[model samples]
Every structure is written in C-alpha cells, then in structure tokens.
Target: MWMGEGFVSEIQHNRGREDTMDDVGHRYLRELVQRCMVLVGKMGSLGKIKTCRMHDLMRDFCVSKAQEENFLHINNILSLKLCEVQNNKVRRLAVILESDENYIEGVKFNEYPYLSYRVCCKLELGNLNYLQTLVNVRPKTIQIPTWFKFNLLQVLKVRNKKGAQDAIQMLISRCPLIEKLHLYGHLKKLPEAHQFSPNLAKLTLSGTKLEEDPMETLKKLPNLKILCFRQAFEKISKYESVGRASFNGKNMVCSKGGFPLLQYLFLGTLYYLEEWRVEEGAMPSLCRLEIEFCSRLKMIPDGLRFIATLQELKIIDMPKPFIDSLNEGGPDFDKVKHVHSLVLKSFCQRMIIVSS
Candidate 1:
C-alpha cells in the first residue's frame, strides 16, 4: 500500500530532488500487480494507478511472517508488559486502542531501541531518536524537549484540535531535514519567522487562519513546489461582492523573483479574497494555477500573462461576475487566453474547457 501510494518517491521529491521511480519502484509495483500480490484501486487523471489495496491472504501471510521474525509488534491492550518489551526485537510498532479508556501510557521504548516507525494516538517521544515518520501525535504546547532530535525524520503530520501554532513552528524548525509536512486544525496564524525549513517542498494547511497575507511569507520558501491552502483563510464578510471589506486587510501580492521553483498552486474555499496582484517576475516557474470557491476574487491578475511556463488554469465555483470577466472577449480574456489549458465551472452550468 505504501509503495503504491508513491510515498517513497514523494519523500524524494519533497527533498528537492527528482523522483527516479521509473527504474525500480514502478517496476516492482507492476510486478506485484501482475503476480496478484496487490489489488489496484483507482486511476489518477494521468492514467496511472493512484490507489491500491493489499490482498487479504497476502496481508495475513506478511503478518504471520512479521510476528515470526519479531519485525513488527501489534499491541491492542491498554498497557504493555516489561517482559514483552524485553523479549521482542520489534522494529515497527502499532498500538490500537479498543476504547477511549485505553491509552499509550505504559509503553517503553528503551526495549526497542531500533524502532523506526510508530503509530499511536499519544506518546512521550524522548527516546525515539531513530524514528523517521511520526503521525497522529500532537504536543500540548510549543516547548519541544531539548533532548529530542529528529535528525533523520522526513515526514511529520499532526492534527491538533486546539491549534498549536507555536508547536507546529517549533517542530518545523527542529526537524531541519523534514521534507513533507501537513498540519490540520484551527490555527489563527503561522509563526512570523524569517526562514522556515529549507528543504520543505510540499505543505498542506487546512482549517487555518492567517492574520497576514500568506504569499508574503510563503514566497520566501526557496524549494516549495506544491502548496495547497484549503479553508485556511478567514473571511470577514458574507456578501458575494468584491471589495476590501471581504478580505479583512489580507490582500496577496507576489513580488519579483518569488516562488522561483513553484509548480502547483491551489487556492480553494477562500470565501473572502477580494484582490490578488501578481508581479511580473513572481512565480516564474509556476505551471498550474487553480482558484476555487473564492467568490469575491475580483479578476484574474493581468501579470499572470507574463508567466511563460503556465500551462493550466482552473476557476471553479466562483462568482458569476468573476467568471464572466474571463470568458471570450471579456475584460480579463486577454490576460488568460494564452494559457495552454483552461477550465471554468460554476454551480449554474456545466464545466467549460478552453484550450489554445
């Protein structure tokens, strides 16, 4: 499942490197599918298998072999025994609690010093130095332990219901080598740091609110390639009109030489965006731009036509006034007519595709 999900290549890509999957990873996945070792699920828009599921028989066989070799340990109980910890040479551990009362309180990591992957709801991460991937864990505050170091860590994903902006920032700073990061929850604003993770290439933020223009800060990221902001901006007005009132003083302006290597940009569900100004030299390498559900966005940035690398532009569920301005002979038609592929969609009608 992990191989089919492209997580391996994704890690390489996030590290600001090309994913050379055609040589080994793709061939291995193909062989697995041909041998009926994996079940293909869904195809992506590019005609590649986007999802796959492991066969039940294969999964059982692997589990039995893993248990036999003590490579992995699955603990469903509320507590762990010191004897079990001392006995098993588990390298990967999965703890699944059957009830809310069950917690990850007594599990000891000293027994399994080589533990690399951990999946649990709660943990005390002081001893897991070799840990490479951490998921479903949220620290209470931003005060990370001075003794903890994620030197080899590549992926960190957290969901904090209370929104730990400072903690998230601290985590990013601590893991200098981290490449892919996903933060989910309510965050009023990101940290006002001058520099962020240098190698970070992909970032996804959901249910976040920014007090300042996000582009002003994000544009400084040198290696960022894919950025998605979904329901992350705060709206000040409910009216379907375009004006400064809708933005609450958060207008985006891309400066010269910004986002030098960015390729994919998605802005969705930003209900109160009023204006976006794109400077001529900004996002020089951008190839795809998508704006969706930003009803109050006034018009397409005229400076976008200056981006020679732009290939795809999509506008979905936007206000009629905004869509009308982009149609043939409309005020903004000339600004976007040069794009190789364009798609516009609204609730009132079917999607329209335009190509040049």
Candidate 2:
C-alpha cells in the first residue's frame, strides 16, 4: 500500500544497483524502527513485517515537527494544512474527525449514512483532480458521473457490485492510468483484453463467477505483474468440462506466451481445483507463487518444472495427500525441487520452511 502511494519512491534511488519498491519500503520501515519511531508488531515466516505501530508520543512529536517545519509541501510550495484552508484546490481531500475518548451508548450507526472513511467524509469526488482512495458503502457509493481529465488516481478498490466487470471496464477507459485495481464484487464476466490499462501492474479479484477461461483473457495484459484470486470461484462437480472455467471444470490450462510480465501469482479458496496445466513459456518471469485453502488440488503443474525463474512456492491449509505429493521421491517432488524457498503450512499450524 505504501508503495502504491509513492511514499518511499525517493528513499532508494540510482545507487548503482537494482532496488525494487519492496526493498525500499522495508528499508524505510527499518529506519523508523531503528530511530525508535515505529515498533514491529507481527513478523511473517519470510522475515517481513505483517503489522506494526507507532507510540502516541512519537506520532504526536512527528506531527508537531512536520507542522513546525511546514513539511507537508507539494512541489516544495503548496503547504497541506488540510482543515485550515477554505480553498478546494489541493488535489486530494481526506476528512478526518477526531473526538473525545468517552464512549457513547446506543448510538445508531444508521444515523450517519453519509459517512465514508479513509477519514470519514460526506463523500463527493466533484472533479477535484487528485484521487487517492474512496472507500464507501455498496456499488452506489461511488459514481464517476463526469469524465476525469487529470487525476492522481492510481489505485481503486470497491465491493458488493453486481456488474463489477462492466463498471471496471468503464473505469479504466476514463482513468486510463490506474496501475493497481482490486475488485471485491461478484463478477459475472471478466473484462476483455483491450479494456485494460497498458500501465496496469497488479490485479486482484475476489468472489467472482467465471463463464469462460479467465487465463485466456488475463494473459493478454501487457504489463500485469501481480495476480491474486481469493474465493473467486465455487465448485460444481456434476457439470464438468476440461479446459473450461477452472472452478466448474476439472482441468485448466496456462498456454504458452501467457502472462509475459507476471512475477507473482496467488490462488486461494479454490475448493475444486484438481489440475492446473502450464504450457512452457507461460509466466516466464514469475518468481513467487502461493496457494492456500485449495483442498482438492492434487498436484503441482508439471510445466512449472520448466520455469527456471520461479524462486518461491508456498502452500497452506491443503489436504495431507496434497502436501505429501511434494515430498522427496513423491510424484510431484521433482517439479518443485528447483525452487529456492518452499514453505508448506499444515492444518495443525505446523509450518515447514525449506530453502534450497
């Protein structure tokens, strides 16, 4: 999330070596921890911080220092003092209301139907160019009534919409620069190839019903690098077809020349995925893959053995039989033997981490 907002973009620059946005973000966090400004809360098995926080004193002190120095400046001129300004041309607007610590009883949340967060607002994006994040209620919470000519809208996430595919397809047409899109609605159809933004690097969809082979369309995205599907499909075993919708069918295929720039892929909650076939040359740049809650997936794709670029694989909450197939001398062992990091999480909360 910090990476998408350009928070640490200037922290690590041309220092003579390749530095990814992930490395920069982590390094910035480390600096804060070293200075006692932030505290690490939870750490992942991969040594990454999953959660963190800052002391109230530290936060207060930082705010005081920033305000004293007039630090919230854009292009080194316009100061962002938010609430104090009467003018409405600062690009992005987020309303944050701070109240007393006393708790109020029996206060109906329905009383404030106009409230929206990321700092509760009486929401309206009336052509005020800079778009950050607008999280609201159902599908009707946001409406792009007028065409956006100039916007800083890089990321968007919406939920509970019936026509998610069409809505997003129309969105990308107006804000053609959106790089990261996360859809939480139930989709009846996946968007076509030409409907995507050429600059898109990450795509995530959850709880969608597929009518066609999604990979057939997703692979055509020119710059997509990260893809995640969470509870995106449900199982219907009686009516099965090979090479059809992955959830409705027993088999799915990843043909050659697909996902050319993709590097990270995650599939979770796919209950009936039994087989995934990857033809050679598919996802050639893929480095990380994670699969969780896919209880019926019996084996790893044989084509993955040919993807030398794959460096890490993580499987979680899978059936014992599925986990056993990746053991030494097992049928699927040879396919993933070349991966540098292999992590398997069991139902008992036991995790096996292997680095080869």
Tens digits of lDDT, candidate 2, 149-226: 324555666555565566556655655666776766566567677877777788877766454567888899899989
Candidate 1 lDDT score at position 30: 70
Over 4 Å off, model 2: 1-58, 62-126, 135-139, 163-165, 232-250, 346-355
Return the top candidate by lDDT.
1
Per-residue accuracy of model 1 over 1-356 as CA lDDT, tens digit each: 23333444542352565665433465567788999999889864334566888978889999999899876788766554536654655446676657554334444554222232223444556665655566655656223377566776656676654557667767666777666666665556665434367887877766665557778778888888888877633344695432211123347888899899888988877766778899999999999999988777788888998999999999988878788888888899989888888888875767575656
- Please state every model's RMSD to the true fold in angstroms: 7.1, 9.3
